[model samples]
Target: MNKYLELALLFAFVLAETVGMWRIFSKCGRKGWLAAIPMLRRYQMGLCAGRDAEGRQLALLESGVAVGIFSCIFFKTGSVSYMVAAFLLLLLIIPYTIFSIRVYFGLCDAFGRNRFWVVPWVLCDWLCALIWGFGSDFKTAEGYPFDDEDAAPEVSGIEADLTAPGLSINITRRTAMSLFKRKVLLRDIHLIIPMGHMVLLLGGSGSGKTTFLNAVTGYEKANAVITLGDSNVYKEYNSMKYDIGFVPQQDLVRGSDTVYRTLSDAASLRLPADMKSDKRRERINEVLDTFGLTPVKSSLVDKLSGGQRKRLSIAMEYISDPTLFILDEPDSGLDGVMARALFEKLRVIANSGKIVIVITHTPDRVADLFDDVVVIAKDAKRTGRLAYYGSVYDARIFFGKKSMEEILMSVNRREEGGEGRADEFVRKYSALAAGGEV
Candidate 1:
C-alpha cells in the first residue's frame, strides 16, 4: 500500500476501535470518553466487568502489552542487550495475554453473556466491542435481577386497595352510511371484564381494535350500550369519566418537562379538587417509586429511552388510580424484553384490583402474562367482530390453535372465505355472556 493509503487505513481502524469501545463503555454505564484515551479504556472496561478491582488488574496487563511492544521495537536495533531485555518483557507479556483473555470473558459474563463471546473478543475485537456496547442490557450497580419473592418486596409500599365493582360490557357498533344504510363494526360484545384482570386485545390492521377501544372510552361516534356494573357507559360519561383512564398509542406528555414534573402536572389536573397539595406530592412520589421512575425522575420526557417513555406515559394515568385503565399499543416501539417487562408491570397493577387492557398487534410473547384475551376479527365488510374471548390457553383450544398469531390468521382466512370458522366459534362461545368462566 502507498504511505498515505496506509495512514488512512490505520486512522480508520483506530477510529472504529475507539468508537466501538466507547459504545461498550457507555452501555456499561461508564463514561464513553474513556475509550478515547490511550490506556484508560482498559481500566474502564475492568470497571464495567465488576468494579475497580478488575479494572486495576486489566490496566496492569495493558501496561505489560505496551512494554512488550516497546521492547520488541528496541530489539529491532540489532543490540544483544536489547534482545535479552525483549525476551524478559515477552515473558511478562505471556501472562498479560492470558489475563487479557480472562478479562474479556469477565466483561461478557458481567453483562449476562456466555463464554461463547471469547472467540469474537479475541479474534474480532472490533465486532465484539460493537456487540457488547449496542446489544447488551447493562443494569446499574444497584440494579439486580430479583427472584419472584424479592420482586414483591421491591414493590411493597406501592400497592393500592382499589375496590371497584366488576364490569360486564355489551356494545353494538354500526356505521352511519345513511339513516337507512348501516354496517355493523362490532356485533353485540357481551363479555364480562372483571375488575383486577390483565386483558389483551388482539387484532390485525383495520380490524377495529382501536375502534373498540375508542368506543369503550366514549371517544368514537357510535351507537353502543357499554355498562360498567349497572351504569350505562354512554349515559353516564360525565359521572364515569373519572373511573376510567385511557393511554393513547402516542405519548401525550410535553417533551420539555422532566418525568417528575410531567407526572406532577397530571396528578394536579386529574386528582380530586378537595385533595391537598401535600397529599398530591406524596402520591406523586409513590407513583414515581412504584414504576421505577425515581432514578430518572429528573430526566426530560424527550430524553428518555423508548421503554422509559412508555412507562412514563402509563405512569401519567396510573397516578389517578383509575378502576379501568386502557392502553393502546403500549408495546408498539419496544423490544421483546421491554415489552415483556411492561406487561409484567401491568400484570401487577391488575393484580392490585383494577382492569387493565392492552390493545396490541404483537401479543404472542406476552400472551401468557395476560389473564384473558379478546380477539376482534374483521369480516368481508370491514367489520370487527368478536372471534374469541377467554383465557389465553382456552382461547387457543377454543380456536384449535397454538398461538395468538395462528388464531388471528385462522380468523382472517375464515373472513376471506376459507371457512366460516370465526362465525361458528362466536356462535358456540356465546354462552360466555351468561356467566361462563372463560
Candidate 2:
C-alpha cells in the first residue's frame, strides 16, 4: 500500500472514532469536546460505562506508555535501551489491555449490547466507536450507575449531650470533584465520643474511614462541626491543634536519632513554646516512662525492635498529652502478642480521660479494649454513611453478628461476598436515630 494512502486511511479512522466518541459523550451528559483529548476521553468513556476506577488506571497507563514510546524514539542516545523499552512496554501493555477490555465491556453493558461487541472493539475500536457513536439505535440503556443523585436523604442519629465534656463531630457532607463532577465522599455523620473512651473506626475499602478521621481532626476540613472540649477544631485550629494528636499508620521517626532525642524534638514542637526548657525535658521523660521507652531512650531508633519503635511513635504523639488522640493502625506489622500489648497501652491512655480513636484492621484481637465501634459503609450512591455507632455489644446485636469482622461482612456489598445490606442498614439506623432508639 502507498504510504500516503495508508496515512489518509489512518486519518479517516481517527476522525470517525473521535466523532463517534463525541456523540457518545454527549449522550451521557458529558461535554462532547472531551473526546478530543486523549487521556480525558478515556476517563470520560470509562465514566459513561460505570468503570471510572479502571478508566483512571487506564488513563495513567496510557500516558506512561506514550511517554515511554516517545522517549525511546527521540531519546535513543540516552541510557534507555530499546530492549529495555520493549520489555517495559510489554509490562504496561498487559494491564492496559485488561483495563481497556473492562472499559469496553462496561460500555457494552451501558449500551445494552452483547459481550460479543468487545471483539470488534478490540480489533477495530475506531469503527466500533463510529458505529456506537452515530447509530441512532445505540442509546444509553440505563442511567450511569455512579451518576450523582438529586439529593441525599437526611441522616439522624443519637446526639450526645452538648453540655458533656467529649469530642463531638457533626459532618454535613464532605465532597470532592471528579471529572468535573461533584462527588460526596461522606455525608450526615454525627456522633459524640465521651472522654476516656477508646472507639474503633471500622469500614471497608473506599468507605471513607480515613476521610471521617481527617474531618474529626480538622486536617481536611469539611462542612462539619467538630469540637474537642469546647475548642472548635476548624475555627480555632491553631490553638486546638495542640489538643489533638494524630499518629499515622507509618511511623515518621528518624533512624539516626535516639529515642530520647526523638521525644525531645517532639516535645519542642508539640508542647507550647513559652514553657521552660527544663519543663519540656521533664515532660519528655514522663512520656518516655509512660510508654516504657525509658529503657531504650539512649538507643537509636534504627536499633529498636518493632514493638519499641511502635511505642516510640505513640510516645512522640503522647508528648502533647492531647485530650483527643487518633491513631491509624497503631499496631500494624506487629505480632498478635505485641498488638495486644499495644492495645493495652492505648486502653490505659483512654482510662486517663482522653478520647482515643483508632483504626485497626485486626480489631477483634483487642475488642475488649474498645468502648465503642463506629461503622461506616458506602450507600447505593457510594457515599460513606454511618451504619452504626454504639457500644461493641450493641453493635453485635444490631447487626446480628457475633464478631466485628462478621459485622463488617454483613454491611459490605454482595459482590464483595457479603450480604450487600449497606443501604438497608443505613436506612434502618437512620430510622432508629430519628426515633431516639439508639
Best by lDDT: 2
Per-residue lDDT of model 2, residues 1-438, tens digit only: 554575577678767778889999998778999888878888888888888888888888878776665555544444558667767878888898889899999999988889899999988888888889888999888655544443336566445454557988889899988644578999998788999999999988788999999989898989888888878889999888888899988988999999999899889898998999988888988889888889889999999998899889988889999999999999999999999998998999999999999999888989999999999988778889899889999999999999999989888876678777787777777777677553
TM-score of 1: 0.58
What residue runs in model 1 are displaced by over 4 Å at the alpha carbon? 1-165, 176-183, 413-421, 431-438
Candidate 2 residue 27 C-alpha distance from true site, Å: 9.2
Q: Write the per-residue lDDT of candidate 1 for residues 60-173, one digit (tens) a residue.
A: 666776666556554545588777768778777677666567777667666666778777787767666766666645432334111101110111111111233566665655
For every model shown, what is its TM-score relative to the native structure? 0.58, 0.78
User: Which residue pairs come into collision in candidate 2?
Assistant: none
Q: Model 1 RMSD to the real structure?
A: 21.6
Worst 10 residues of 2 by lDDT: 143-152
Backbone clash pairs for candidate 1 read: none
Task: State the displacement of the C-alpha of residue 167, model 2, in Å, after optimal TM-score superposition.
Answer: 1.0
What are the Cα lDDT values of the candidates? 0.72, 0.85
